[model samples]
Target chain A: LAKTTQPISMDSYEGQEVNITCSHNNIATNDYITWYQQFPSQGPRFIIQGYKTKVTNEVASLFIPADRKSSTLSLPRVSLSDTAVYYCLVGWRGGGNKLTFGTGTQLKVEL
Target chain B: EAGVAQSPRYKIIEKRQSVAFWCNPISGHATLYWYQQILGQGPKLLIQFQNNGVVDDSQLPKDRFSAERLKGVDSTLKIQPAKLEDSAVYLCASVPGQNTEAFFGQGTRLTVV
Candidate 1:
């Protein structure tokens, strides 16, 4: 399992873009970086995942640099509803899918 | 498509009591996971199951925590002699196969009084 470190909390305004970065210095070649969004009292939902370069989806975009040691999740035009706890996980799927989650970055989007 | 299903959305029990939570993963998913989320903290992986076998339960407190996924369809997590610190949300998630994102259920909130 690759240890991930991210910001504890962040504050943003509505209709603004928020970028949360996570660093995993020991990421393996087979490991992929995945992000999940969680709201109060609800299970986390998948946001975006990437192995290298950039992967864009409807909700967010994941940018992985050449080193693969760090990745950034960008939420474009985030709304108040996007305020949630975002977790960054780095792991592989083989023998046992052991996913280690970090403290996560509590994103606060206000108007 | 239906997602993961968990019953008894909320459970309240006294200390020294036992409680079990159920989880039905998405149809055709071969992998299941159990996670515990405490207040003000991120979810932690407690156990992982592939089909009907246990993959990992290193973080699970074996003294009181036990889980099973028989027949490889649904799973149940039980806590014997619960403690006040056992109060947390138990989450169940599953994925279609390898290297894919996991789908999570609403989770079961257990409160030990």
Candidate 2:
């Protein structure tokens, strides 16, 4: 399992772009970086995933550097409803698939 | 398509009592997972099931916790002789075998007194 480190909390205003960075110094070659967003009393929802470089979707964009040690999740045009705890995880697609979640960054979107 | 469904939404029980939570995965999902989420912390995987068989259960406390997904559709997790530390939300999630993202149910909040 790879250990990930990220910010504890971040504050952003509505319509601003919010970027949360995660560092996984021990990431293995087979490991893929994934991010999940969790609202209170709800299960974590997958936002985006990537191995290297940049991957974007309608929800968010994931930017992984060449070194693969760190990845950033960018949420554009944030809304108050986007406030939630965002987790960064590193693991393979299958085979064990044990997800070790770190204390994610609590992103609060202000009005 | 309906997402994962879990009930009862909230459970309050005394220490040493037993409580069971139920989860119904989406139709045709092959993999199911259970997670424990404590306050101020991210969710932790307790077990995973591939259809009706267990895939991974290394983090599950076998002594007091047991889960089964029989017939590969609905599942149940039971904790006997619960303790105060058992207070947390139990989440159920399911994913298609290929590349679909895992969908989670609104978790069951367990409060042990």
Best by DockQ: 1
Tens-digit lDDT track for model 2 on A1-111?
A: 899999999999999999999999999998999999999878899999899999999999999999999999999999999999999999887633666789999999999
Instruction: Report every candidate's CA lDDT.
Output: 0.93, 0.92
Stretches off by above 4 angstroms in model 1 are: A93-96
List fnat per candidate, in order.
0.54, 0.50
TM-score of each: 0.97, 0.95
Check candidate 1 and list the clashing pairs: none
Per-residue lDDT, model 2, residue A74, is 97
lDDT of 1 by residue, A1-111 (tens): 789999999999999999999999999999989999999989999999889999999999999999999999999999999999999999885544677778999999999
Kindly report the docking quality category of candidate 1. Answer: medium
